[model samples]
Target chain A: MTQPAIELDGVGKRYWKIQERSLLRSLVRFGPPNKTELWALRDANLLVEPGETIGIVGRNGAGKSTLLRLLAGVSRPTTGTVTTRGRIAPLLSVGVGFHQEMTGRENIYVNGMLLGFGKSRIDTLFDEIVEFADLADFIDTPVKFYSSGMYMRLGFSVAMHVEPDVLLVDEVLAVGDIGFRIRSLDRMREMHRSGTAVVFVSHWLQAVQLLCPRAVCMHRGQIVFDGPTEGALARHHELLTSDADSAEYARGTVRVENRQLLKLDGSPAGTVQQDSAMIYRVELHFDESVESPQVLFQVYAEDGTFVYQMQTPLGESWRTLSAGAIATLDVTFLPRFGGGGTFRNVVVVTSIDTSVTYVRDDGLAYFVEPRIGAAGLSDLEAKIAIDGVDRTESRPMRFGGTWAAVEGA
Target chain B: MNNRSLLISLAQKEFRVRYKRAWLGVIWSIALPIFQSAVMVFIFSRVGRFGSGSSFNYAAFVLAGMVPWLYLSASVASSTTSIVDASDITVKIAFPRAILPLVSPVANLFTLAISVLILFIALPIVGASVGPRFLFVLPAAVLLCAFTATLGLALGALYVYFRDVKFMVQAVLLVWIYITPIVYPPSALKGAAPWLDFNPLTGIVGLFQRAVGAPVPSVRALLVSVATTLVLGVVAIRAHHRHDRLFVDLL
Candidate 1:
């Protein structure tokens, strides 16, 4: 059997959370010192074979970003070690290391070298990078003048051209238009097919499902689940819908004393699909007196966009909810709203008609894997036709060819 | 893998991008400092009556001091901010973090070389005889750069964590000009001159003056400066090697 391209054993990182901003003040302070230690990751172990596409799914602050940073070798592991055999290319946040004053062409060289490319290799791949970015004419203009889409496109272009042996992709794919997003993903797939080990960190489960056969889910700096993408995602969904899901947050005025995603018959239903006609009944037990109680539920697409929101009637429903009272609110809809990815629901209990919020239980994520050739978070049953003749119904419409290979041609 | 070549390439990149937008282009590097030296010559000779001695033409004297002082100050300022400014790049890519701070000295070399050449031509016109002794300026310049690199690398690495190192360097630089013997001859300090030898840069400036027929630095002062530079250089390299990859986390 081939050796794993990358290996991590008991890896961890510790951060000193400095309470004071200025360095001078810390020199003399002796009383209860203003500092805290945060273990961003601990005892994490993984072995990835070459060409394996692994997805990392977790809530915010779950150490997903920290794991990517470690793999990129941008920071040393405070404990343990990480070993990798080939060149690493990290597609971090949007416009990572791009100089605003530099033109697109100049930035390519700078970025290329930073990613461990030799000058000769950069020279050979120069035309391909520019062509992939589709900024043929605007290459000479300063990057500051480029739109946010153009900037991200250029950054993604450089990363893809490096032909990295190990690709570390953070959620930077969330930016750019839908078209470019699909193109970049296809490019990543091409790299994966050619034996580039890939680790993708994203909150969107659909993107993970589509790209990664295996995945790992992190919770509070620990790997909660690791296996097939479906199993990891199922555990992730359980973490979202479980009774103990978001109640663990230490901050905030009101705590989700209790939460339940129930079926119409009041039975616990942990799994919900994209096309299921399911009623999402969210019952929140508040710990404090929330005046003019308004429970808000927002659903996000795989790309992290606000696809839709459902809130209890603003002025009319559940006024002045007393402390310790269980406020069971229900949202029944035809689950056809999302396209095909992981959808996260943020259950927020706020003061009606005011910006003041009382309780928020985040990280309630679920998976929605629609049938083949579906688009986006929810299938909105979008029908396109010419003079009443349905295009999709009659024949599979070609939305241009696959974007990666045919891009330059 | 080849650090020297990578450093040279990074340095070239820094120079190209820095002046890419200027209307006068790369010539601005040569023009701005020459203009400043010209102004200093006029002030000291005409208004300040700042001649160190009758035999010494104040123009040549001021040019010697101005060129090196400018090199030191500009390089220091650039080095202090180098890591912080390149935080964007460092946080993403893996390379020698020291390359960021080294960029200042490398780019400033162009302007530094020009000033040295200008001083060479002005020596005879300003009443100083030119000889092979002038060749000492080459080693002196090299020493000055090595010293700056050691100091800048240490400070730039430290500043990533402490953050106050940048401002502290700024404050020290403001007062450092007066103490470095840049604007006056070492003899002008008189009785205090012996103690002032402790300053590392004092010996460097003294070396430049010595090459140009000014007073040779006391043996004690020369030893102190060279020692300080070597010690600082070793400490800086150790610190950088220890903290190179970790610096990006803070950035």
Candidate 2:
């Protein structure tokens, strides 16, 4: 077996949260600066072979960016070692080190050199970079004149042309237009095929799922789960929901608990098929008396786009509840998401007139499999006919077992 | 690809971007020093009178001093804040952080070269005899840049933690020229001339003055300048090596 392309051996990073950064205060203070230690990452050990892509999923401050910084060699781990076999290109952000006053051509050469490419090498790949960026006309124009998308495209184009052995991507794919995104994705896929090791970090679970087969889920500076992408995402959601639960309990008014997505038979639903009916259920415990509580349901795609929202009828009085009352709320709906992505179900409890919000439950998330050969935001369930002959699958693709199993399919 | 080439390209970019939009372009680089030198020569020649009985031409001596002084002040000021100014790049990319501090000195070499050329051209008009001693300006320029770059590296690293270094540097530069024996000769200080040998820039500015037929700086002053550069160089290099990857954390 060849060597792993990237390796992290028992890595940990400790950051000192300095209370006061003033030089005079630091000088006058006793032993050390007033600081608390924060371990951004702890005991992380990972190895990726050549041609492998791994996604990282985590909530904010969960050590995801810290890990990427280590991988990029931008920061040193306080403990252990991080090793990469060959050239590493960090696409942490597009347009890093790009001078606004410099022409596009000049900026490309400078950015390429900063990434460790020689001027002669940049010259050889200059045409290809500009063409890929689709900025042939603006190559001579100063970057300050280019649109933000154009700047990002040029930066991405230069980075892709480097063809690094190990690529570290952190949410840079979210930039640029759809056409450019697609092209950049294709470029990444090409890099993946050519035996490059990739570590991708993003909040967009759908993009992570599409790009990486394997993933690591981070929580509170620890790797809670490292497995297939589906399992990692599931673990990530579990951590998020649990964190939200503790925060909600601290609010002290109405507490939302036991949020779940359930099947018709009351079993917990892991993955729902397109157009399949599932119920979102939650328990609301009120600390004070409430009048005519209403429920609002919202669905969000994995990328945080609001997919659907519905609420209780306006100006309608259900029933008033006395203090210390516990109420269970359930709403049933079909998962009609196209392109088969993970989605979240959120329920908000409020007054009948919507004047006041009592409690908002941390969302429960589930997966939806698309109709066969269907891709988009909504599953239109369209039929195609050729010469009066209908050509559409009579039954939608069946997604069985838990969401993790769907990764193999 | 290598740090050297990266430094050269970055410096080139820095040099070009400075005057990219300005209508006068690089002439500003040549013009600023000449104008400053002209004003200094006019005022000091009348009021200061430090150079009245001097053997060498006073205009040439002042211009010679201004060449390195302008480069030193400009390079040091910019390079001291270089790392902080490039926080966007430093926080993301991985490179030797020391390079950021060194870039300004290298970039200002263009202006330095122009000032030196103008000094040489004006020497003849100012009645100073140009001789083979003029070649001393080459080593003088090199040593001047080395000293400026090392100081910049050290200050740039410190600036990441204490922002007061920025204002301190500016304040120091304002008062630095008066003490460096630039407008006046060291002999003009009378018995206090020996004390002037302690300033690090005394030796550097002395070389420029020497190029235009001023007396050679004291051995003690040259030793002090070289020693300061060596000590600062060691401190700067070690600081960067230890804090290179860690600088991004603070940034």
Q: Which ranges of candidate 1 are over 4 A from the true structure?
A: A21-23, A241-271, A281-333, A342-365, A376-409, B45-55
lDDT of 1 by residue, A249-333 (tens): 6455566544455556667655566555555555566677777777777777545788788777876655676777775666665
RMSD of each: 5.8, 3.4
A1-409 per-residue lDDT for model 2 (tens digits): 9899999999999999988787787778887557999999999999999888899999899999999889888899999999988888888777888999999999998888888888899999999999999999999999999999999999889889998999888889877898998798888878888988888998866667667778899998999998877788778877766676665454656777778878889997765767668888888888888888888888888777888889888679878888899988888888887677767788787887888877666467666754555666788878889998998755322221233255466
Displacement of residue A233 (Cα, Å) in model 1 is 2.3
Query: Which window of 10 residues has the lowest lDDT sum in candidate 2 chain A?
Result: A395-404
Best-fitting candidate, scored by TM-score: 2
Task: For residue B125, give model 1's deviation from the true position in Å.
Answer: 3.6
List of chain B TM-scores, one per candidate: 0.93, 0.98
Q: What are the Cα lDDT values of the candidates?
A: 0.77, 0.86
B121-154 per-residue lDDT for model 1 (tens digits):
8899778888898887887898888888878888
Give the C-alpha miss distance for residue B159 in model 1, angstroms. Answer: 1.0
